[model samples]
Target: MTETTPYDADRARFTRQAPARLVLCDHAVDVADGAAGLVATEHDPDARPGGRVSQAVQLLELTERALVSAVIYERERGSSWAEITQYLGIGPAEAEKRFAAKLAGWDTAFDVPYRLDDTGRKRIPQLPTAAYDPAWACTQLDRWAGNRLILVDNEHPVSSGLVMAVPKT
Candidate 1:
């Protein structure tokens, strides 16, 4: 089961702190194809070697932004800002300035509780088995910040693991 998975997890539950990026990525894009899409998009870049690295970093930032908002949505449910910041790999002050304060402007509806039971106790939220609509996440993603979500597949062996986001038009 784990072999076929795009992500490797150390625990089955979502911790009080933010889960690892691969785990969260797997959780956000639930469809196997979508997960594959994320992976594909992550690797696909029009830029050459140096440009490719920059683009990849941008895609990474986009993923972090989406994941941060997702975690913030969960925080509204009961999680703490401290845990979210930790997951974001930032300190409280920086988190407050760049992340936590942005929640009011973000789309709250997508901030659905990815977990239903106790995350810190006996029950932890596991990666979603359900499929997610890419077009929908794309459109909804626009609401969050004009950022885009992309997943492209080709005939080659390319496997992307990130979604690119740009400022909204």
Candidate 2:
């Protein structure tokens, strides 16, 4: 009798090379199931509550930072205001109003290439554009970074796409 290894070398290699984070946000039921499984398997009620609280708080803080970073990174990467607005689930003006304070100190120096019409009127929307604010961006970036997971909405362009923005140290 021969014994075979369970690991698939090809799949492991592909995963190792992929640069982006694979966030499975689509299918709320699947996410909930996964979360439930994790919670059930990873946590023990007998464990000290203090430790759990501390870990939760730390995770929250990290998530906030990752959210902000991801927003800024996405802006830098040339995402559109419309896209941003959609992601934020807010009107352009409202989103800007909410995040103005945190963005005040940051420079909107980054340029994004976008074609306005079929003729190709390339223009760069101002950094921290109305759609995204520094504070909110920071919060989102932190959230994404902390989660180390991606949530994919069926409506999003990249259905089942992964999005992870780890701040380069």
Candidate 3:
């Protein structure tokens, strides 16, 4: 038998409220503030070198990087790998390899389709997903409604993912 975790319970609760619209949003401000707080706490002489603050800072950095990747993917939705690589300052293979997972998550979060019509021709739309919008993200955060659920890792002060929750309203 598998042991049940709190996360699993939360997910179950979230799923039971399914058929509800889920919205994903970026955690830009939360990540920034958390990073700043970590830096501040770390600056204290009494604080240990590898304490919660240090760990939080690392997580915040990762979240920031993920957010950056999401932004780039949104900005260059239809661009080729070569183009994305150039913009990201990484080689084609590296770019794809590094961002593939994150991009997949983003794609799912945004409910982006495989193709869109452009000029009467099928083409990929750049940032077709509204989840990347900072304003939308903020609104969701404020409302706390819908399938959008913010995942806040205890280790980090800010959220990691803006998961959609079942809309109560």
The prediction achieving the highest TM-score against the true structure is 3
Candidate 3's C-alpha runs over 4 A off are 1-25, 39-46, 52-72, 109-136, 140-169
Candidates' TM-scores?
0.33, 0.34, 0.40
lDDT, candidate 1, 79-140, per-residue tens: 56677677677776777677645555332312332333556333222322211223332233
- Per-residue accuracy of model 2 over 21-58 as CA lDDT, tens digit each: 11111122233434444355356666675765665565
Which residue pairs in candidate 1 collide? 39-159, 39-160, 39-161, 40-160, 42-162, 146-168
Q: Rank order by lDDT, top first?
A: 3, 1, 2
Candidate 1 ranges with C-alpha deviation above 4 Å:
1-27, 30-51, 89-93, 107-169
The TM-score of candidate 2 is 0.34
Per-residue accuracy of model 3 over 1-169 as CA lDDT, tens digit each: 1333223333333321121112222344345456656656455777676676576867767686655554454434356777656656778888777777766655464344234455635545233223333334334444442233356333322122333455555
For residue 3, model 3's alpha carbon misses the true position, in angstroms, by 29
Sort by TM-score, top down from the best: 3, 2, 1
Model 1: worst 10 consecutive residues (lDDT sum)? 1-10
- Rate residue 52 of model 1 by lDDT: 51
Error of 1 at 164 (Å): 30
